[model samples]
Target: MREAAEPRRVARVILLDPEDRILLLHGHEPDDPTTTWWFTPGGGLEGEESREEAALRELAEETGITEVELGPVLWRRYCSFPFAGRRWDQDEWYYLARTTQTATAPAGLTELEQRSVAGLRWWTSAELSAARETVYPDRLAELLQRLLDEGPPSVPLVLAPEIV
Candidate 1:
């Protein structure tokens, strides 16, 4: 049997506007620009930080939007993907946050992000559902629709594993 790799715990934010559009960051591998995907704003927790703490900190760092209230965990997923030059096995927790500020100034990106991130955009659920380009978490459009209709689930929903 193959041994499973240890998963890195990452906190991610599902940032939504009052109009219910979701925010996503567009990124590509530094060495392979053609390989691109849209993902939420978040990163691995540092030290012994709580998931909420990491989510809030990553939100501010990645988008320059702060002073927003964060809601409960909305979703969870285990994913493995190749990024930069290494393969990552990640266990990700998704938190819901709302923001009126849409302008993003990614001033706090680490060197890796600076090299990999292409841009950020706001996406409506319809757009996401119809998009042909790659987006992380696979079923984001359906997930957002459910969240909009029912709010956060009592327990975070476990998403399908994404391997890419």
Candidate 2:
């Protein structure tokens, strides 16, 4: 009998800017619970592809930013949980990226439900305090606060730029 393959590692960028704004995306898929809510922009790493390449692809796909700057990842982690008697697999990767020039709305997305997420808004640290409930109840808010207080982190903030 053949053994099942192990889940590969993946990395994503939880992009932020000097303005204290973190890029949040709202994917409007019915099957996706966080569709309506805001979460940092990022996705999975492809086979044998560099983390930097995957980060660029995922960021472009989700946020429609063709231009980005990739900085050293701010966070790295491995998370696993099961649902409905099946293993839910995800190796989340988070990088802290920022854009050099102003950003434009995503031109078009392949996903159907994610289309309605045109409501891109920038939230400051203070604003996050008020809208804390809108995000996942994890260390995200706390991390943001720490980043804000300390300013340009001693660690590199993942920075990415859009290129055609």
Candidate 3:
């Protein structure tokens, strides 16, 4: 058995536009650009900031979308993966947010993000389902469609570990 790494607490936003398309960031591992995936906009909490605060801050910094209506935590996940030469164990909270901003101009990005992030795009559930590329939190298309059909769940859904 392998040793368990300390979990890094992270807050991620599932940003949706009025058109219902979800925003996602396309990025790759810094150490291996060939390995890529599309993921939500969010990052780890800074200082004593709450997950909600971190979600908003990260969203603005990554996508320049600050004017948003932050919704509830829709999902939670414990994922472990390797990137940029280090292994990450992340306990993440996925919050739902709506924004009118369609275009993105990054306000701020850390060195790591600057290197890892490739682009940002809005994805319809159909596009996600048809995509040949990878998307984090597997089954995201199905999950998203579920959320669209039925509003946010009364309780946050606990997702299975994504170990890779």
Candidate 4:
């Protein structure tokens, strides 16, 4: 069971490759709540901006991944909870970003400066799978496997997470 959403905003990306890596950022968990061991590079969507634009802006600002093809909405979760006695609502949206060049981002980003994320490394699917306990785990991995068996397709993915 899940609780109702709180009042907050957030946007994110799921940059992937034919090989198993997806762009990710490492960060220290909040001390008080102890949440967020690590998180992808993203921020809140400004008013009147569409989700796609917000996502693109966030990736560019955080990971220097501007000018890439942003795909359809791949995953969306409206979650809220209390941690360290503070209520928070996180409406996160994930997208598939395809690019020919690698990405660049700041390093040594701290929780403050909020934009302090400075990670510029590629993480393999195996790494993501291994960190499922902390980071997001979605069917995109299975989709990657499928694409491996059959070369990348020219279709849009209306995906929902796989459950066992």
lDDT of 2 by residue, 1-164 (tens): 99866654666666666576777665343454553566666555768788788888777776677666676666554545442344535555566677753474655444543544645556676777677455532456777887668744666433331111
TM-score of each candidate? 0.94, 0.69, 0.95, 0.65
lDDT per residue (tens digit) for residues 12-121 in model 3: 99999999999999999876778889999999989999999999999999999988999999999999988888888899999999989888998698999999999899
Q: Count the clashes in each prediction.
A: 0, 20, 0, 4
The residue-by-residue lDDT of candidate 1 on 29-77, one tens digit each, is 9877788999999999999999999999998988888867899999999
Better of 2 and 4 by TM-score: 2
What clash count does candidate 4 reach?
4
Scored by Cα lDDT, where does model 2 land?
Answer: 0.60
lDDT of 3: 0.94
Query: Please, what are the lDDT tens digits per residue for candidate 4 over residues 88-144?
Result: 566677666776657475532334524333234677756645555454435445655
- 2 or 3: which has the higher lDDT? 3
Poorest stretch of ten by lDDT in candidate 1: 60-69
TM-score of candidate 2 to 2 decimals? 0.69
| RMSD in Å for all candidates | 1.6, 7.0, 1.8, 5.4
lDDT of 2 at 47: 84
lDDT for each candidate structure: 0.91, 0.60, 0.94, 0.59
| lDDT score of residue 131 within candidate 1 | 93
Compared with the true structure, the alpha-carbon lDDT of candidate 4 equals 0.59
Worst 10 residues of 3 by lDDT: 28-37
